[model samples]
Target chain A: MSSTLTVADVERIAALAQLELTAEEKQLFTKQLADILDYAEQLQAVDTSGVPATAHVLGEPVERDDAERPSLAIDEAVGNAPDPASAPGLFRVPRVIG
Target chain B: MLQSTASAIREDVASGRVSAVEVCRAFLDRTTAVNAALNAFNLVTSERALAQAAEIDRRRAAGQTLGVLAGVPVAIKDNLCVRGMTTTASSRILEHFVPPYDATVVARLAAADAVVIGKTNCDEFAMGSSNENSAFGPVRNPWAQDRTPGGSSGGSAAAVAARCAPLALGSDTGGSIRQPAGFCGVVGLKPTYGRVSRYGLLAFASSLDQIGPFTHTVRDAALALSAIAGADPSDATASREAVPDFAASLTGDIKGLRIGVPRAFVADGVDAGVRAAFDAAIGTLRGSGAQLVDIELPHARYAIPVYYLVATAEASSNLARYDGVRYGYRSARDKDQNLKQMYSRTRDEGFGAEVKRRIMLGTYVLSAGYYDAYYLKAQQVRTLVRQDYQQAFEKVDVIAMPTSPIPPFRLGERTGDPLQMYLADVFTVSANLAGLPAISVPCGFSEGHLPVGLQLTGRMFDEATLLRAADAYERETDWHAQAPAI
Candidate 1:
């Protein structure tokens, strides 16, 4: 829990998060993240032998009827697409299957 | 009209003393006049607001009954979408993205006849403790331009404090609303989790996120909450619990009410002026027939640590949709680049430094080997934090403390260090972790005339008691009546 964060660790996390970081950003994050994690290391001392984790304060997962209902219109849903004009009623993204 | 409460404005508009359009114009004019100095609003929807106001006026002329919040102007934090309005979460990624639907809360406000005047600026994706992280620029404190109106709901708080609007909406995730409300000298309330729907609010940390209000008075905060609380079909997590008439609950009577005080926890690391004001507020409460009982929240000291881990993890997952595939900013394509490269490039270009840092931290904490160490441990500790509150509430109806440990800091003072900025939310994060209702009211001012806030955390789904206690305090003092010179 007191592990030291390194530049390589940050690079790995950045890749996992799909974010491209500059050399300066990587260096800065390495120091800052290490300090923050160091501060968070205090949590490791709290003994939890049989305590259950709390994901949410809600009592139970709520369910709704699985039936047809009004939903977002295709044009309205795609209104904010980066390239909405490229294809009618669809969001155009860079070719992925190629 | 600018200085009037939402209740007063509604009465005036309803009785034909003033048209709803006039009330809208009064707030819009005040927003335009002060926004240049405060940078409170990112986009002022003059056309939409005027249209809404005109509809309210027409209904009045047609002999129809007005809603609870009839003709009151309200500013919204930019993260909550408004149909056809560009809802930027104070980030470049969504800078030009216009939603095709209104947030449930927004629709509810409209149903209550409250005019939405504008979208206020905030921390990008509501991440920073200071509003300086906004792509639109920082919102200055109305009391002092050099200091921050504590963020990420800083703009909404500043707007209400500056009298740009009688009421405003803000989202609280780790003190975004209450901290700023304290800094701006206004009444800010974060209802219990699921009390308000999160259907259209740009998700930050799903479990911790809750939408609330910033108003000039506790009664007005109660009014705004009544307009927006309850179950929503669009949001599954919305509580099925009954929505009480929050404004009607404010009888300004807290006789023999049990108040919990965690004196040891708040004794250290507090500014002298802020501590003094807090003590004075406690004394006032005691003098007003409220009984104070000492309580201990030992696990609360770790709230900041648990919050950062829990919130960032959820944010990383929630923000993963911004891959430039469907909406928002997309990076320029290169003939040789692959789809994966486009995602990294777009995210790198679109997100701010704080957002990226949190994303990276979240990814790290949830990664393979570190999951149990950071993320799981945080969840376990979160249970402790919640249990601490449950036990405390068994003995006392509400727990009281200073909303913020110190007076407002300068805009650029804590921006350089993210940890330092996070430490500022020390006193306000536990309520969110515990999923309880909390309110921040103007307690007193510092030697420099900067405002201080006294926070009250109440039982789950018990905002009625919270508002009652705060309203009672307001009747005993005139702190909420003191506005900034601006």
Candidate 2:
């Protein structure tokens, strides 16, 4: 029941992931990813009919008192920013809109 | 002194048998001597390590009692941030990005007076089973330089096996800690999920990722775990449960302990040598008062596929933050490109082949058409896997299994095949998926002289029993005593 992934599928997947793959990557991934996915099709054979999905094993959210605490200083938070230090103390990015 | 365990190192340092600085220097010298062959450490923080050691010595001179891990040399996996150190996750993306803070575990180790020697290598973003996926380089197995030390914690395990560091920190998302330890013939333990804080561990899979220790002995693992395992105000996921004295449980008496041996773990495709070693280890457990109980983990067979779906999905989202703007590697190709092109180019250039595969697969599974069919189904199967553990634990105190179905393979054997590499983790991922504490301790050696490890997984938050059982086996067997002639 498992067919190979097409070149078009790799392109669409790469685009969705915001990745720019070379032509070699496209061809290689189409086969490799398809093989992995086909192998993963083994899970479908098992009946998980009414099993509840486990988003987290603990399932219960940890409750903590919401209290004010010290946080990372602004400079520390943006210390590794690629942009130059700015007066607004924020990392500058490419202009979003004209 | 070269083969000293972490616990012994701490005691010797505190008792004035050796100065902390000298202890650190000895390991640092050993690291410099052998790291070229092992390639275990990505960056040896010699200056920082000496500084920390000097402080410990000063305190000891002032007659102040030391912490348990005081003066023990530790190598942290590159994934954990140490303030101002280039805490690259062995990926090109963060090759130069330094965090401004220490991880919760790092801070704890510092407070405990442990000396951190350096950062060890790992798979790019902790994505692969073999160390070959590392952007820096594969950590050659100390046992056989031609073979890969199992990974993505290969560097940590290799450093310990090579005696570059007596204790090292590794993060386990899907057996990154245990598999490599299994391959390297050392002790590694992944605490129950939320047992240890995850604040500074570069996220591979948030829910599944756990910081653990690689040590020469089970008692050393217990000591290291004690130093780092506790609740942190910064990490809400860390459990507030009072940590038991893990070392105290190593009484070498596990009389009447029930250890479940899951047939699924020893099923077909496991190497003959590994299976033989596993059966012999089970026999040793029987000799040491641990009762063998046959058990069924019906849905555990789906662990590999489920882990890939869940961990990659988490990776896809967690790694999306590394765009061109704020931090991490932004490609020079982004110079004149638009915002969209900048993001694509930076990621495309930053991530290695395996990391890109996971990201793309993660993005695909989480996309509109496949989310329900793949990701959701995997999560549902994850529930079944957890249930299987829950039911099995009802009848046994711990589950004993082979750590890896195969021994260490040649460095490039599985590089071209992702599925085969993923299967290397088949026996180890179920513990991660179920959020249980598991330890891999040297059990026996294969015919090739490569090491094999026995895995013992305990109930949630029951690390004491797991460590005690492992220590009992270590006491009864000389496997842990044998080190590879590096």
Candidate 3:
């Protein structure tokens, strides 16, 4: 019931997650990743029959009114940005899709 | 006066015996002294706590009324957001992230005038049974430095157990709060799902994640629950039912209560010390006039599997929001790549190893062709697990079991073996799946001097009954009073 997660698998996952893992991180993660997956596999053996799958336990569909409300000032939201001048109203990041 | 419970703190402020500022300073000082060893808190908001305390004092001086938990210092799990405070979820991904708003529980606690002392550490993204997954570092067991404080709410439990704060809030997806509480020898309750609002608490398993409290005593736990429990406008899934006064039912009276013992699930594979302590706890309850009956939950064996499928699937979806475009960490590389590459690179850089592992497994399970066999089948089994609890509750008022199978193991003992670590949560996972209210209260200490908790689970939304039983048990034994030697 145990499986080893390889470095390639880790790299693929990092790609999927939009992360840039260093080579050392990938190596360290290979062992740690395998251990976690092995642990999660323990759930495979439990018998669940007739038990209703609950997406949410509260069961009650809590909906809020879709009314518009005053929003946070744009400056306030971006005020804490490490570099506010890079982008006028949004967080500036490195160029993408070149 | 500073040692009083949240209820007493409110009363004292009202009666003018102590000022809110005085209470805040006392807890702040204690938190400072022990935080170095426990690593329980990621940040201590002394200035903010003092400011809030001063406001409470102003209201008291002006003869204005205060909420039930007025001026009580409470620590919140880092996963739960607080306005203008860092909500890291103990992961490197959100290491510099500061939430702009408060979680539903945080907002409610603030409304009640509860002074938030700081944010406590947890397993990264509430993923692990032990706190070792935290990127910041493992939170040491307050009771024993070498052993772990159970997680993902280890910091919260340790904070409460070490007397740093009388009360703390923690999230339990799969026994995060309860397991850590057990390891640290404190009272931790996981309310029925939706009993507390989940508006701003970081989602782990959207279905199972619940925020509850850790406290020194059962009564304290009840008071904290009352303050945080109730429906909220922000969380659409919040229960519409009125929250009862949990502290009002603290008079230990379970005269004809049918306490069910799940012979198949709880009794098997339990450590000898845990079993002895559990049996002794049952004997004490029996002596107290509570009837203990054997109940079989045939689907109990499948709880772990169903929990993982459902939890991981939902976690995969929920964690998808952590793209670098919106918030948190973004990869410095992959700039020239398309949106897909940007997303992949950001998430890979942001999330810790455990989080990435789960996302991958979830994606694989829910992928095309495998969905029906793995994800769909697991969902069907989840229904069965829920049914078992429903049927069991029809016959019993509450169920009793050992909170964890063994005492807190060494920090790195199970790190190398993931399955062994997941097995640690076996006894505590079913309650979350069933959306039942459960608590882990210190029952006894192991030979190695670690705390053992007796887990009491009750029917959905039946937290009062669980509290009553735990209060009665605490009355007879002084186990909850035993602190870690450190």
Best by TM-score: 1
Stretches of candidate 1 above 4 Å error? A1-3, B333-335
lDDT of 1 by residue, B428-464 (tens): 8889999999999999999799999999999999999
Best by lDDT: 1
* Better model by TM-score: candidate 2 vs candidate 3: 2
Worst 10-residue lDDT window for candidate 2 chain B reads: B331-340
Q: Give per-model TM-scores.
A: 0.99, 0.98, 0.93
TM-score-best of 1 and 3: 1
lDDT digits (tens) for residues B1-486 of candidate 3: 434566677788778899989999998998898889889999999999999999999998998988888888899999998888988899877888887778988888888888999999989999988899998999999888888999999999998887777789999999999999999999999999888998898998888889999987899888888888887878777888789999899888778888999987876788888888889998888888899889988877877777777788888888988776646766667436666666677777677777876776676567666576567777776677777888988888999999999999999998876667877888899899888899999999888878999999998888889999999999999998776655
User: Model 1 misses residue B107 by how many Å?
Assistant: 0.3
Chain B TM-score for the candidates in order: 0.99, 0.99, 0.97
Model 1 chain B worst lDDT window (10 residues): B330-339
Clashing pairs in 1: none
Evaluate all candidate structures by whole-model CA lDDT and list the values in order. 0.93, 0.90, 0.83
- Residue pairs with backbone overlap in model 2: none
